[model samples]
Target: MRLSTVILPIHRWAEGQKIWRRAEDLGFHAAYTYDHLSWRSFRDGPWFGAMPTLTAAASVTQRMRLGTLVTSPNFRHPVTLAKELISLDDISGGRITLGIGAGGTGFDATALGQEPWTPRERADRFAEFVPLLDRLLTEGSVSYEGDHYSAHEARNIPGCVQRPRLPFAVAATGPRGLKLVARHGQAWVTTGDPTLYENGTPEQSVEALRGQAGKLADACAALGRDVSGIEKVLLTGFTPDRGRPLTSLDAFVDFAGRHQELGFTELVIHWPIPDSDFAADEKVFERIALEAPAQLR
Candidate 1:
C-alpha cells in the first residue's frame, strides 16, 4: 500500500515550505492538505487557501504528488475551480489529484454567508458538480447548464498536462456518492464512518469500512467497471483508533495490515501537530512514514 500525509495549511510559507519538502524527502507517495477556508480547530488560527498552498508545495517538492484531501461544492463553483485545477495540474507537472466530496455542514458550509445545505441538497449539488467539472477539464471549451451549475463556453484551453485531466480521488461512502466514484473516480476516499468516530470500537469501524467498500464494489459492478481499477484510500485519524496507529512502527504495521486486508490501497495519516487534535510523537510518526509501508509489504 502507498502511504501519504495530510499537512494542514497552518504554517507560513517560510516554515511550510520545509514541511512540504520534508514530506517528499521522507518518501511519502503524496502529500495532501485539507481544502477549507478554515477548518474546525484551526478556524481561528492562520489557515491558508488550499490552492495557493498547493501551488507553493508544488514549487518546493519535485516527486511527491500533491492535492487537497477534498475540495467541495460548498463554496466552489465548478467553472472557476476547473480553471484553477488546470493551472495547478500544469504547475505541478501533472502531479495533481483532485479529492472532491459532497461537503458537510461545518464552518465551510456557511463561510460564504449562506445557510448550510441539507444532506440531500449537498448530494444533489455534488452530483451536478463532478460531471460538469469533468467535461471542463477534458474539452477545450464547455457551454452547458445544469440544475445547480452552468458554463458559458468556459474555456480550459491547453487543458490539463495529465491528458484527459488529472486523476480524481473522489471521497464518498453513500450510494449516490459511490455511483459518482464508480463513474469518475480514480481513487475512492473514506474517513471511516463519522457516527463511529466518538463511540465506536476499532472492530466496528473496520466493519463499517468493509460495508462501505462492498457498496463501492456494487456500484462499480452496476456500471460494468472494474472495482480494482479504483484505488481505495483511508484517511486515518477519524477512525476510532485515532492516533494509536501512529504511536509506533509496529502499531502502524498492525493497523495498516488490518485495513490492507480490506483492500485499502492507500493510507493517509495526518502530519503531527504539537498539542492539537492531530498531536502525536513526531518521531514515531516519522518512523511510520519511513518504515511501516515496507514492513506492510
Candidate 2:
C-alpha cells in the first residue's frame, strides 16, 4: 500500500510547517492537512486554513499530493472554492486531491454560525453540494439551481492543472457515511485507537477500522464503482516506546493488510499530534514524519 503523512495539524503551526518540509524530504507519498476552526485535543492552538497552507506547501514540495483531509460547503461558496482550488492546482502542477465531507460535529457548525444538523441531513446536503462542485471543477462552467446551491454560469477561471478534475475523496465514519464514500470519494479514511482492548490487544480498534473498510468495499461494488478508485487511510499512530511491550507498528501494519484485503489501494497514517504545550510532545511530529516513510515502504 502507498503511504502519506498527516500534516502536523494540531498545534505549533510553525513547527507543523517544518514537519511538512521534513516529510517531503523523506519522500512520503502525499502530504495531507485539515481545516477545523476549534478543538482542544492533544494538539491545540490556532489552526491554519487548509487551502492556503496547501498552497504554501505546494510551493515547497516538488512531488507530493497536497489535500485538505476534508473540505466542506459551509466554509466556502462553490464558486469561491473552485477559484482557490484552481489556483492551487495550477500552482501545484495538478498534484492535489480534494477530500471533502459534510460538516461534522456541532462545534464545527457553531464556529461557522450554522446549527448542527443530523448526520443524515449533513449527508443529504453533501449529496447536493459535492456534485455541483465536482461539475464546476471538471466542466469549468456550471448552471444549476438546487435546494442548497445555485449557480448561474459558474466559471472555473483558467481551469485547474489536473485535467478531468482532481480526485475526489470522502472521509466518512459510519454506514450511511460509507455509502457517501462509495459514491463520491476516490479515497476513504479511518481512525486508529491506541488503547489496549479488554482482551489486552489492540485488535478491537483495528477490527473496528477493518469493519468500516469492509462496508466501504461492499458499498463501492453496489454502486458500480471500481474499488481501486478509492484509497483507504488510517490514523492515530502513537507507537513510540516499545520495549517489546506492545509494538504499535505491528498493529498499524496489521490494519493495513486487513484494509488491503478489503480493497484499499493506499493507507495514510495519521498520528495524534499531542497536546502541544510541551517541546517534547511537539518533537513527536518529526519522529512520525521520519518513521512513516520507512514503514510505508
Candidate 3:
C-alpha cells in the first residue's frame, strides 16, 4: 500500500512548503491539506485557503502528488473551482488529485450565513456538484442548471494537464455517495466510523473500516464498475480525544496491514504537531518512514 501524509494549513506558508518538500523527500506517495474555511474544533485557529496552499505546495514538491483532503460545494462554485483546479494541475505538472465530499454541517456550512441543510439536502447538493464538476472539467464549455448549482457558458480553457481532468479521490460512506464515487472517482477515501473512533476502540474502528471497504466494493459491483481500478484510501491518524495519540511504529505497521488486507491501496494520516489535534512527536513519523514500509509489505 502507498503511504501518504496530510499537513494541516495551520502553519505559515514557508513552513508548509518545507513540510511538502520533506514529504516527498521522506518517500511519501502523496501529500494533502484539509480544505475548509475553518475546521471543526480548530475553527478559531489559524486556517488558510486550500487553493493557495496547494498551489504553493505544488511549486515546492516534485514527486509526491498533492491535493486537498476534500473540497465541498459549501463555499465553492464548481465553475470557479474547475478553473482553479486546472491551473493547479498545470502548475503541478499533472500531479494534482481532487478529494471531494459532501459539505459537512460545521464551520464551512454556515460560515457564509447560508441556511443549514439536513443530511438529505447535503447529499442532494453533492449529487449535483460532482457531475457538474466533471462536465465542467472535461467539456470545453458547459451550460447547465440544477437544483443546487447552475453553470452558464462556463468555459474551461486549455483544459487540464491530466488528459480528461485531474483524478478525483471522492470521499463516500453512504450508498448514494458511493454511487457518485463509482460514477466519477478514480479513488475512494473514507474516515471510517467517527462514532467508533470517539469511543476510543481502535480494534472496533479497524473492523468497521474493513466493513466500509467491503461496502465500497459492493457499491462498485452494483454499478458494474471494476473495483481494482478504483483506489482505496483510509485515514487512520485521527484521535478519539481531540488530541493526537502517540502511535508506535509497530502499531502503524499493523494499521497499514489491516487496511491493506481490506484492499485499501493507500493510507493517509495527519502529520504530527505539538499539543494539537494530531499531536505527536515527529519521531513517530520518522520511525514509521524507516520501518513500516518493509514490515507491512
Candidate 4:
C-alpha cells in the first residue's frame, strides 16, 4: 500500500512550510492541506490557502505531491480550477493529485464570493466540472454544456503535462458518492472511520462502511468498469482511543485495516487538522503527526 502524510499546519503559518519540507525529506508520497477559510479559535498564524500554498510548495518539494484534502466545486469554475490543478502538476513533475468533494457548508463559498450550492446542485456542478476538467487537462479544446457551466470556445491552452492528465480524485462519502468515484475518478478519497459505529459496536461500524463501499462496487459494475480494479482510498482522521493507557490506536488502524483488507489502495492521514491555527491545541496536531503514522502501519 502507498503511504502518505498530511501537513496538519498548527501554531504558525511557517509550520506549514516546515511540515512540507519535512514530509518531502521523510519521503512521503503526498503533502495535502485542508480547505478552510477560518476556524473556531486561535485565529492567528502564518496560514496558506490550499491552492496558493501549493504554488510555493511545488517550488520547495522535489518528489512529494501537493493538493487540498478536498476543495469545493463552488470555489472556482471548472475550467479555471482545472488550470490550477494542471499548473501545480506541471510544477511538481506530475506529482500533484486533486481531492475535491460535493462541497458542504457554505461558509467558505460565501467568504470567497462564490455562492454555495445545494447537495444536488453540488453534484450537478461536479458532473459539469468533471467533464470540463477532463477536457481542459487532457484535450487541447473543450466544448462543454451543462446546467452550472458551459464552454463552447475554449482551448486546452497550457494544459497539464501529466500523462493521465492531473491524476484527479474525489473525496466521497455515502453510496452515491462512492459509485461516483468508480465512474469518473482515479480513486475514492474519504475521511473519518468508515467503520461507523463509534459508541456502538464493531459490527455496526463495519456494516455501515461496508454498505457504503458496496454501493461503489455496484456502481462500477453498472458502468461496465472492472469493479475489482477500482482503487479504494480512505483519508482517515478520527481519533478513536487505543487499547490501554496509551490508547492502543486501535480505532483508526483497525478501522482502516478492515477496509484495507477490503482492498484500499491508499489511506492518507490528516488528523485533527483544524481549519486554522490551534496554537493552544497543538497536541492534537503533534500527537497525530508523530503517532498516527505508526498506527497506520
Candidate 5:
C-alpha cells in the first residue's frame, strides 16, 4: 500500500526542484517524471530532460526513490542509457529505479526521425533491448549483436550501487511484455487499458487490472519465477476520462483500496496541474500527506 506520484517537468528547474523536495516531505515513497522527447498533448508545452531533472532531484531528496515513469527504446540505445543510469544510481545513492517499457506510437516514436514500427517489431526490439541493458548493467565487457541493438565490449566500470544493478520496474500489459517482466524486472507496473477505463465502470477497470495481473502471474509461472518478489505498481491517474478521477483524499483512498485488493503493492497518482488532463485541487495532496500514511501503512 505504498504511495507515489509523478511530477511532470513542465516547470522551471527551481519550481521542479521544489516539487521534488515537497513530494519527499509529503511522505511519498517514490517520485517520477516521464521519459520522452515530448509527450502527447504536452508536446508543444515546456518539458525538460528526464535524466538531468532526476539528477538534480537526487541531490535534493534524501530518502525517496526517483526515476522516469518509463523509459523506452524509442530513442535511446541501451549501451548509452546504461552508462547514464549507472552514473545516476551513483548520484542517487542506489535510490534509482528504471521504469522501462516497449514504447508506444507517440511523438517520441517518430521524434528521432526513425521508421514507424508495428507492435510486433516494437516487441522484438524491446526483447533485445532489456537483456542487453541487463547484461551491461550487471556484467563487465559485454558484447551483443541483436536485430535492433548491439554493444561492443561495453565496459561497466564500478557497476551500480544497488548490488547487481539498479532495480528495473518494467511496464507491461501483453504476454510477451510480461515475459520480459518475469525475466528481468524487480517490479511490474500497469495502467490497465486506457480504453477500458474510458468506457467501463470502476469495477470493470479493477477487473481488467486483475486480468492483467493474472497474465503476469502466468508469465512468471512459465519461467518458474516467484511472482511474490516482484512489486506490483498501478498507475491510477492514467486517463482523464476514467471513472471518478483521484481528485481528493477520498477518491484516492477508494482508488488505491480497489487496486490493493487486486494485489498492487504500490499506487501512483499524478500531481495536479492548474489546467491539464490530470487537473485537480492541489490541496488534496496536502490532505493525503497528512492522513494517508497511517491508514495505508
Candidate 6:
C-alpha cells in the first residue's frame, strides 16, 4: 500500500514549503491538503487557500504528487475550478490529483453568507458538479446546463497535462456518491463513519468501512466497471482510533495492515501538528513516513 500525508493549509508558505519538500524527501507517495475556506478548529487561525498552497508546493517538490484532500461545490463553480485545476496540473508537470466530495454543512457550507445545503441538496449539487467539471477539463469548449450548474461554451485550450485531465480521487460513502465514484473516480476516498468517530470502537469502524467498500463494489458492478480499477484510499484520523495510528511505528504498521487487509490501496495520515486534533510526535510521524510502508510490504 502507498502512504501519503495531508498537510493542513495552516502554515504560511515560508515554513510550509519545507514541509512539502520534506514529504517528498521522506518518500511519501503523495501529499495533500484540505480544501476549505476555513476548517474545523483552524477556522480562526492562519489557514491558506488550497490552490495557492498547492501551486507553491508543486513549484518546490519534484517527484511527490500533490492535491487537495477534497474540493467541493460549497463555494466553487466548476468553470472557475476547472481553469485553476488545469493550471495546477500543468505547473506540477502532471503530478496532480483532484480529491472531490459532496461537501458537508461545515463552515465552508455557509461561509459565503448563504444558508447551508441539506444533505439532499449537497448530493444534488455534487452530482451536477462532477460531470460538468469532467467535460470542462477534457473538452475544448463546453456549453451545458443542468439543474445545479450551467457552463456556456466554456473554453479550455491546451487542456490538462494528464491526458483525460488530472485523476479524480472522489470521496464518498453513500449510494448516489458511490455511483459517481464508479462512473468517474480514478480513486475512492473515505474517512470511515463520522457517526462512529466520537464513541465507537476501532473494530466497529473497520466493519463500517467494510460495508462502505462493499457498496462501492456493487456500484462498480452495476456499471460494468472493475472495482479494482479504482484505488481505495482511507484518509485516517476521522475514525474512532483517531491519531492512535501515528503514536509509534508499530502502531502505524498495525493500523495500515488492518486497513490494507480491507483493500485500502492508499492510507493518508495527517502531518503532525503540535496541539490540534492531529497532534502527534514529529519523530514518530517521520519514522512512520520512512519505515512503516516497508514493514507493511
Ranking of all predicted structures according to lDDT, beginning with the best and ending with the worst:
6, 1, 5, 3, 2, 4
lDDT of 1 by residue, 18-126 (tens): 9999999889999999998888888889999999999999999898999999999999999999999999999999999999999999899998999999999999999
State TM-scores per candidate.
0.99, 0.80, 0.95, 0.80, 0.97, 0.99
Q: What is the clash count for each candidate, in the order shown?
A: 0, 3, 0, 9, 0, 0
Instruction: Single out the weakest 10-residue window by summed lDDT for candidate 6.
Output: 37-46
The lDDT for every candidate, in the order shown, is: 0.95, 0.67, 0.85, 0.64, 0.87, 0.95
Error of 2 at 140 (Å): 2.4
Tens digits of per-residue lDDT, candidate 4, 42-125, equal 235444567777777788788877877777676667777777787778778878877777777645657776666667777777
Over the stretch 1-297, how does candidate 2's per-residue lDDT look in tens digits? 676766645545466667677767866778888666554453244666787788878887888888876687656677778878888899999999887877666356667677777777777777788778878888857899988778999888668777777887776776666787787677786554334322334446556666677678788899898766777765434322111211344544555555566456666655334433222333443454455436644
Greater lDDT among 1 and 2 belongs to 1
Tally clashes: model 6: 0
What is candidate 5's lDDT per residue for 207-256, written digit by digit as tens?
78889999999999999999998999887666333525456677767676
- Put down candidate 6 lDDT per residue, 167-202, tens digits, no spaces: 999999999999999999999999999999999999
TM-score of structure candidate 1: 0.99
TM-score for candidate 3, please give it: 0.95
Clashing residue pairs found in predicted model 1: none
Clashing pairs in 3: none
Show the colliding residue pairs in model 4: 13-46, 140-156, 190-235, 195-205, 197-205, 242-247, 242-248, 242-249, 243-248
For candidate 5, give the lDDT of residue 59: 97
Question: Would you give me the overall lDDT of model 5?
Answer: 0.87
